[model samples]
Structures are given as structure tokens and as C-alpha cells.
Target: MTIPIALTIAGSDSSGGAGIQADLKSFAALGVYGASVITALTAQNTRGVTGIHQVPADFVTAQINAVFADLEVRAVKIGMVAELAVIDAIAAGLTRWLPKHIVLDPVMVATSGDRLLAAEAVEGLRTKLIPRASLITPNLPEAAALLNEPLAAGEAAIESQGRRLLAMGCPAVLIKGGHGQGAESIDYLVRDSGVIALAAPRIATRNTHGTGCSLSSAIAAGLAKGEDMETAVRYAKAWVSAAIAAADRLGVGHGHGPIHHFHRFY
Candidate 1:
């Protein structure tokens, strides 16, 4: 049987809660074949990131070339690029292959409050990678970092932030409202035409380690299965909400734990 393929270019989380591991799990959970190119290897757990070892930029390029050469990649999700060099390499590879759907999850900070991406790499992400994205999913801190401004104050400010991000050249931008104060989490998707608000009752759980990675990868999976942008976003939001709701069942680590990626199945 033919299967749709999705590629993730990111770091590796030793605890398997975020980065490449989370992205791959998300792809598989959504029924998309998953491939990966590791940009960095992180020594991290639910508590925090202890150390990080960046993969050589040339090796990162090689990995991307290998994947695109062999597989018919339908969608690509980018996350946790540690340095400017890695970002440059990824940008070059994406430019060459020109994947149909590119979902950029601007993962600057981890759930453990560890900074993942370097400050200098932010410019590379904005100028190079953002332009190539089919959609970008940025949390409040990430969005603020990208725009070099303070966090959006409320819903109206969030919508404005999304629009400003869209103006950066990405076709669409989703400013995740998880960090905002509300009974429900509301994500604003801003496109050139209009805005789409996706809301879900906030699931209270410390096991929310890989939420951003999973959400972006799930969106990529939906797009790979031929869903439209809005449809993909909605499906992804629902899936993540369910996963978050079921996360407490795992009872894994001492700190924040991972969501159940296969909650629908088992």
C-alpha cells in the first residue's frame, strides 16, 4: 500500500518527549510515514535540558539530501534548530527539494524553560525558513522573539501578531494561545485573506512536554493526507487536545511528561 511521507528536521530529545522523537511519533499517530534529520542531540528530560551537541551543518545537509533523494516527502516539519549554521543548511536543502507542505514550528524555548535555538539563529529563521513555510506555528514567546517585541497582551494582540508574522512572507501563521490567560486555548491562524480562530478547552496537565512539536507534525500529517490548511489545523488541534487530556495516564517522569500520541488507538 502507498503511504504518505513526512520529514522532520530537528533535534533529538533523549527523553523522547520533544524534538525529532515527538515529531516522528506525531506523524505515525496521524498515519503518515515519518523520516528525520537530527540537527542536534539534546540531553534532556521532563525536568530540563542539561546539555546539547549540535550535528555538523554539512552532516545535516547530507541527512536531508538522503531523505529527499529516497522518499517522496509530502510534508516537512521543522523544529529545534540550535544554531544559525544548521538553519542555513536546512534552508538550502528545502530550497532545493521544495517540499509541498512545510510546517515551521519556531521552537525557541522548551517546556522546561530551556532555550533551544540560539539568539542569532532567530534572524535566519525569520529571513530564510519563514519564507518557505506553508504554515508556521509559534507559541507566544517564540512569536515575540521572532518579531523582537513583547508578548501579545490578549486575543486582539494575538491576532495582530499573527498578521505581522504572515507579513514576514510565510503564507500562513498560527500564533498558539496556550500561553495566554483563558479558560480555553485559542490559536489564531492568520492568512492574507482573513483569520481563523481555533479554540479548545484547556487541558490541565503537567504532561505537556511536546505539545508544539506534536501539533505541527500533526498538521503536516493532515496536509500530507490532502487536507486543506484550515482542515489540517482543526484536525491537529483536536488530536493534540485529546492527547493532552490523556497524558496524565502515562505517569512517567517526575516533571512534565509527554502526551499520549497514540491515545486514539490504545
Candidate 2:
């Protein structure tokens, strides 16, 4: 039995809502074997994060080496790297392994529109890591942060940002418009070929804590299963939409709860 495998290099959320937990859940839900390399440990629940303990850069490198050394990892999703050194270590690991697909969710901006990474770390990420990704998935504020521009309020501006980001060395960029106000949530997949707009009906629910992490991991799962970039992205969006639609049933947390990753089975 040849099961596809995907790796997630990210922080661990104690609440199991976001970060590494969400990534692993998304991988399993999508039928891909999951492996992980944790960069940090976060004290967080659905309400918010309270504390974080970053793993030492060398230890992070060790974890990455351990996973890549054993697993037949077909794709990788990266998230929540808190330090410049950690970013450097992750970039080094990617350079070593050369995974077929690398999905980078630039998890630098929070839902409250706050910067999560230090300025230097952000610069390191921009320079060293972004160029190595097969695709970068950035929310509106994150994309703006990467380009040091104002939030794009329309399609043309979003595409322009995507194009600029693509020039930053990533072959493709997914500009997610979840922060935008509308009946539909739209995400743009910008490649040299053109932009593909993926839209889904916006679900009204507070239980969306892990949406970005899960979406990117789902994309990794699809890629691990041998889907093309567009197909993987389309399937991920649809799957995440359904998970968000079904999130209310979980009743897990008081504020911004997690989506039901296993919504299909239970």
C-alpha cells in the first residue's frame, strides 16, 4: 500500500485548533499520511493565544532532519515560524530535502491585523523562504505586509499584489480575501499564466480559528496525492468551506472555535 505523505513544519497549538494540530488533522481528513516538525509550542485556546515557547533553531533542524530522513514526504506546508533563525533553519531543511511541493502559509498577520513576526524575522522570511515555496498562501494583511503596501480593496489591486509577490521568486501566490466583506469569500491564484479566482459562499460562524492552516494543509494533501496546483487549491477551498459550514456543530470553544476537521465522518 503506497499512501501519500505530507509534512507540516509549524507551531503546536495546545488547543489543537490551529497550527500543527490543524495541519495534521487536515492531512488525515484528506487521506494523506501526516508528519510534523514543531517549531514552537503555543499556549492557546479558541479565545486567543496567551504565551509561546519557541523551539531552539538547532532542535527544529533536528526535527526536520528526522522527519525528512524517514518519511516519503511528497508535499510540505509551513506555518507560524516565530524567529529569524527558525526561518533560516526551515529554509535549510527545504533546500536539503527539495520536496516536490512546498506550500507556505505566511502566518505573519493575525486575525486582529497585528504583526506576529519581528521586523527582521519578516525580512528573513521574505528574502530566504518566500523564494523557495512552490506556492505562497497569504491573507490580505499578510500579503500587504510582505509587499509593504496598503490593504488592497479590489480585484485589480489584489492581482497586482499577487503579481508583485510572484516576482519575489515564488512561482505562484494565493491572495486570500477572507478579510474582505461580502457574501462570497474569494481567493485568487496568480501564476504566470493568469489569475484564477476561487469563490465560495461565505459561511457565517465564529468557529474559524484554523481556517488558513487547514486550507494550506488540505492543499498539501491534494498535492501529495498528485493533484496539480489549481486542482489542489480548488479542492482545498471547497473542503474548507464545507468544514466551516459544519463548524457550528462542534461547539468546542467559546470564541472563534475550530472547524470540524472530521466533519465528513462524524
Candidate 3:
């Protein structure tokens, strides 16, 4: 049988750790075919994102259109869109040819503290993209930025934002707790029905590059395989934690690097 197809619309990371690269790695690990529409190009290594070039809106649109024309994509994971125009392009594409399953990661800043999306782009995301998502996976900082509301620390903050994100027109919200400085990485998933917390002890490692990209892409991969949203997110979290545990010691950057993508599945 042919592998299931999933599309990742994100920026390209030359480091091969985050963004489109990480998404591809995650999808492949989960036994899915991966496709991409690169929104921007980043010149960075494990050190950090040194330079970025945002693709024009027309170019982004063409890439998406070209892929959709040939691929029977089962799910979509959106990563970095650096400009308001890029967001508008994505919104237009989604409205015209809606993907069956859309997962928005709302990637704003990199773990290495490099700003990927423009500050102005966040507003466009709230207004245009959140409503179209099957789920929005945002770390605490991203959640706060999207809601334009300050949040208290820990699980309560994630839960609060998850609910508020639902109010913003998303069917579900996965407020990722990776950014919460704590012992356990607590991820909160909220739907119209209720909220579920997927908690695991955070693994201390320097190889955590592309983690957000991996988690969301894994969820998209799971959805492509016909899993439920809860099941998908839960499984994705477990995998990402494992990935962190097996992260290779790139030792190139001050920030966490990327986890090994070839570890044997437990």
C-alpha cells in the first residue's frame, strides 16, 4: 500500500533540525509520506537562526497550489509564516481549497530566541488562521501573544489559553507546556467537550531543536493514519519526549540542539 500523505507548510531550516526539516523527519518516523510548501528560508545551524528570507506571498501560494494539485494530503501542519502577507496567502488558500485536517503550530520564535514571524503577523493569525485549524499548538509565550492576554505560569495558564483559543474559533487547542520552566512538561489539549493534560517529566538535553515542529508534525502524521485528536496529540507527545531523550549531542549551539531522528522505536 502507498504511504499516507501529509503536508507541512513551514519555513526551511538549513540546520535540518526544525521547521520543514523537522516536520519531514517526524512524518517519516511515523510512517507517513511528507510534502512541504516552504514559507521562508533560514540560514542557521545549531547555533541559531542568523538570517531569514521570507518567500513572497505569490510564491507561497504557488507552492501550495502545486502540491495540492498532485497530492491527496490527509493532514496539514503549518509552521513559520514570517509576514502578514504570508498569513493572508495561507488564509486565502485554505478558504479556496480547505484541507481536511489542519494543525497550526503558530511558530513565532525559535527555541534559540530568534524571531521568525513578524510581530504584526500574530494579529493576522488570530483573525485568519486560528478558526480554520483543527487544532492550534502554541507554547506559553505564543499562546499569550495570540490571546493578547497575560497568563499565569504552569498548567493553569495553558488550560486557560486552550479554552480561550477555542473561543477564537479553533475546534481544539493544544497549549504546549514545553516552555513552562518546570520539572514536568505538561501539555494541555482543550476541545468543546473538555480538556486533557498530557504530562511527562521534561528530559534535560541540549538536543531539542525542532521539538515543536516534531510534536505538531507527529500529530499530523497520527491524524493522517486515522487516529483521533486526543490519541494523536498523546502519541505525539510521547514520541517527542522520547526524541528528546535520544537527542544527539550536536554541541554546536548554546541552546538545545536536535534529538536523534533515527533511534529505534521502543
Q: Pick the candidate with the highest lDDT.
A: 1
Model 3, position 5, has a per-residue lDDT of 96
Cα deviation at 63, candidate 2, in Å, is 0.6
TM-score of each: 0.99, 0.98, 0.95
Return the TM-score for candidate 2, rounded to 2 decimals: 0.98
lDDT of 1 by residue, 1-266 (tens): 78999999999999999899999999998899999999999999999999999999999999999999999999999999989999999999998999999999999999999998888888999999999999999999899989989998987888888889988899999999889877999999999999888999988889999999999999999999999999999999999999999999889799999999989898
RMSD of each: 0.7, 1.0, 1.6
Candidate 2 stretches greater than 4 Å from native? 112-115
* True-structure Cα RMSD, model 1: 0.7
* Model 2 poorest ten-residue lDDT run: 109-118
Error of 2 at 104 (Å): 0.2
Arrange candidates by TM-score, highest first: which order? 1, 2, 3
lDDT of 2 by residue, 32-56 (tens): 9999999988888887777788899
- How many residue pairs in model 1 have overlapping backbones? 0
